[model samples]
Target: MTATPRAVDAKEILLTWLTDQVSVPVVSTRPDNKDAPATFVRLLLTGGTGRHDRALHTTQLTIDSYAPTTAAAVELALAVDAAVHGAVAGLSPVVRVSGTSPSESPDPDTTSARATATYQITTRLLT
Candidate 1:
């Protein structure tokens, strides 16, 4: 049988993923109401099983600004992945993102603008 990945390895990967999620360039767009710009970032993972089952863990990153489209979100996701690798390599795990959307407030705020980017990270436990 093959050996499973270690907790340290897994966590390291996750942490690295988290770091990448935020500190990177992502999808962006120009807003009609505002010119501040918007950005989105997120990281996610799910794995682990058997005698060395690790608890499920998730890391999420969201950016809400006037930057623009889902491009920022995509960039952020990639960045997060890179960051995690740089921060903590050897985290040989898998991660999947369900969705990436750009949303704005129906109502205007003092700034008269609203937008957001969301990201999710998740891990699973197997017996």
Candidate 2:
């Protein structure tokens, strides 16, 4: 008898990877810090797919880079893009990583400038 392949937590994997690679704090949700830094990255898992017969998983994520200024936000978004691509070799399970160009997306609630980008990460799950 053969055992079914296990599903991986794509969000956790990405959060862990980005936290280590990025200079700024990487969080899944808005920080509760009373004195939050001027720059930070927030990650949201938009969607994903997996097969029962295979250990391969693909996850889509939205990355929001926030800063005090629009220029700073854009710079941070670019840095994040580089860091995400750099993970392809370092992350064992990750098979590929792709992303769209970061665009300006100012936040409605705050005066902080924001940049947004989408990424697709494909990983091979361990049995």
Candidate 3:
């Protein structure tokens, strides 16, 4: 009943936290992968009530590779997602990733050699 508003508020709070993400370093040495260090992350989280008892939380996060190539953008996204999942796992209130659809947007500065992109992530939160 009253939990509906609470859920929306919680979603907003999480959205705010994600949109203003900070850059973190990458330390992966996989032979087939050269992870690109993250530069920045922006999230556009939006969602509300849904069918049945299921609630949804959708977030569109963006990342900048600084000077890496398209390949780098992917590694950065992984690191960012890992960091995000960890933080959410330790959230005060319990929440889970019911479903997730992550995609990478084309580079903004196509002319530049540096790689940069925005990730659109749709995450459903079932209450």
Instruction: Compare the candidates by TM-score and give the number of the best one.
Output: 2
Output the TM-score of candidate 1.
0.31
Best by lDDT: 2
lDDT of 3 by residue, 55-113 (tens): 54444333333324455555655655654565456554424433242345564534312
Which order, best to worst by lDDT?
2, 3, 1
The lDDT for every candidate, in the order shown, is 0.40, 0.84, 0.41
RMSD of 2: 1.8
Query: Can you tell me which runs of candidate 1 are displaced by over 4 Å?
Result: 1-55, 67-94, 106-112, 123-127
- TM-score, candidate number 2: 0.89
lDDT (Cα, tens digit) per residue for candidate 2, span 1-127: 8666665676788788878887888888866467877789999989865553366778889999999899999999999898888878887788888879999998897778999999988888666
Candidate 1 residue 88 Cα shift, in angstroms, is: 15
Window of ten residues with lowest summed lDDT in model 3:
25-34
Q: Per-residue lDDT tens digits of candidate 1, residues 1-127?
A: 7565332334444444454446532332233344433443322233323222355544454444322344444444445444543433333334433335646532243333334445443434322
What lDDT score goes with residue 40 in model 1?
A: 33
Tell how far residue 37 is off in model 2, in angstroms: 2.1
